[model samples]
Target: METIEKRKWSVNSVLLVLLFTLFGAFAVFPIVTLIIASFKPAQELMRFGLNLKIDPALFSFKNYAYLFTGESLYLTWYWNSLLISAVFTVLCLLLSSMVGYGLAVYQFRFRNLVFVLVLVMTMIPIEIIILPLYKLSITLNLINSMWGIILPFVVAPLPIFFFRQYASGLPRDFLDAARVDGCTELGTFFRIMMPLMAPAFSSMAILQALFSWNNFLWPLIVLRTNEQLTIPIGLATLLTPYGNNFDMLIAGAVLAILPILAVFLFFQKYFIEGMTAGGVKG
Candidate 1:
């Protein structure tokens, strides 16, 4: 009976691995196709769209060369995206985490009400408030500025909620210890709690960076100038009624993936831990 049970377990494990392998291939298929498509000429892309079947002989470095040497404003757009994402991620993490930590740790009047309001804010779609936000941006003279993009959604609801939940799981003993040691409130947070919350920080860093990097609608509405456009907006302009620059578009897209990919890889070790801990803790 034991031998039979072992055999059954082995079979199940093998089947599970095969299933996951199939799913992994499916997930990776599009990215593989995009990378392959980047190497081909714009004419070939316009003719074939995106596909894996292509003549290797036709592939060349011209697309990549054009990205660097050509007069296209690809580099400017890339710099804009990187700067916006970095600043936004840092500000979002610091502010949202503090707000969340306060909610989780402090005993104050109407605290529950405040948290409920945050929840409600998360439920409310950005589309509903975008008009007011746009008007406000114009009033503040933030239009066509990077700060216009960064300032509006810096304290995003979702990250606040996540950080609150994660902070709730932390032990109050650390807070007491820090206070007893004569650490200031801000010092306590920075010195004592922030390190303990490293996993949460890592997880949110990736998520917030990804959001800022890929954000489209808000930036589109706020930034009017060509030079101020993010990568998504810039790449989108390549396709127009007059002509299409599929060569630069595809190549630019491939390069665009690198920053986000690097961020994920950097924080990946803590991501799963933070997510699982946050999910269960609060």
Candidate 2:
């Protein structure tokens, strides 16, 4: 019976390894394809399209060279994206987390109603309210500016909801203890409670960063100048009616993935913990 159990355990272990290998391959395939395509010349890409196979003789750094040295404005787009995403992520985390912590810990009239409004806002798509957002941006003279894009999404509803759920799981004793130690209401939240919610902040930071990085439609509407365009919008302009810069486009996309990957790796330790801790309360 012991020998049979050992065999069963070995079989299960093998199956789990195989399953995870398959999933890893599935996730890595597209990224591998993109990297390979970046090396190939534009003519080759136009002719053969994207394929996994690499030919060392055919691949070169010409695309990347052109991206950096040429008058393509690629680096401008990269810088713009980095700046906007960084600022947006920091602001969203601060504003949303505070709103969430307030809803979670404090008692006030219309607290539940405000939370319900956040939930309803999450259910609504950006496509639905973009018209109003555009009008508001125009009214505030934020058109053709980074602030237009950043301000509209700074207090994202989803992050607020997530933070609120996560904060709910935090002990009220921490708040009381901080108050007893002479911390003011704002001081307790900023100095005491905020540190305890590191995992939640890390998770939301990654999320909000990705959203700002990949945001295309809103940036497209707001930013008109070439230098002001984010990476997504700038990369899109490469496919104009006059020319199709497949080489630069593909290489730029691969380069763009680096920052996002770095952010994830940096905050990875807290990601799963944050999700699970918050989810338990909800």
Candidate 3:
């Protein structure tokens, strides 16, 4: 009987491993296809579209060479995306985490009401307010500028909600201990609380960076100049009524995935922990 139970347990573990391996392959398939597609020429891509029918003879570095050496604006767009994502991620984490920490830790009049409003704001779609936001951007002379994209959504509600939930689970004993040690309020947050909240910060850093990096509609509305366009918009311009630059487009896309991939890999260790703890704690 014991032997049978042990065999059953081993079978279950094997099944779970196989299930997850299948899922991982599914997730990785498109990326693998895209990478393969990047090496092929524009004519092959136009003829075949994206696939995994590997042709060693057709593969060459010409697309990448053109992407780098030609007068393509790929590098400029990449720089713009990297800069915007980095700045926006830092600012959003700082501002939103502070607001969330305050809401979670402090006692004040109408505190519940303020939290309720934040929850409500999260439910409201950005599309509803985008027109007003655009007009405001125009008024502030932020159009065609990176700050125009960064400033408007810096204090995003989702991060505020997430941080608040995570902060609620923290021990209040630290707050009192810091105060007894003569640490200023700001110092307490900067030194004591921030380190304890590392998991939360890591999780949000990836999320906010991904959002800012892929963000399209807002940047499209705000930015008018080709030189100032982000990666998505820039890549899109390669396809037009007059001509299509499939080689540059696919190669540029594969390159564009690196920064976000790096951000995810850097923070991935803490991401699952933060999400699970934050969800359960508050």
Model 2 earns a TM-score of 0.89
Model 3 gets an lDDT of: 0.88
> How does model 1 score by TM-score?
0.89
Which of candidates 1 and 3 is the stronger one according to TM-score? 1
lDDT (Cα, tens digit) per residue for candidate 1, span 1-282: 867766555787899999999999999888888888888988888887878886879989889889887598888998999899999999999999999999989999999999999888878889899999999999999999999999989998878888888888999899999999999999999999989988788888877788788998999899888889999999988989999888998899999997667756777776555445435545
Lowest lDDT 10-residue stretch of candidate 2: 272-281
Candidate 2, which segments miss by more than 4 Å at Cα?
A: 1-26, 269-281
| Candidate 3 colliding pairs | none
**Worst ten in a row by lDDT for model 3:** 273-282
For candidate 2, write residues 132-192 as lDDT tens digits: 9999999999999989999988998878988898898999898999999999999999999
The TM-score values for the models, in the order shown, are: 0.89, 0.89, 0.88
Q: After superposition, how far is residue 214 of candidate 3 from its true place, in Å?
A: 1.1
The candidate, 2 or 3, that scores higher on lDDT is 2
Per-model C-alpha RMSD: 3.1, 3.2, 3.2
Instruction: List residue ranges in candidate 1 displaced over 4 A.
Output: 1-22, 273-281
Worst 10 residues of 1 by lDDT: 273-282
Clashing pairs in 2: none
lDDT of 3 by residue, 1-282 (tens): 867766455787899989999999899999999999999988988888879988999988888888787488888898899899999999999999999999999999999999899878878989999999999999999999999999989998888888998888899999999999999999999999989988788888877888888998999899998889999989888889999988898899898897668756877776665445435545
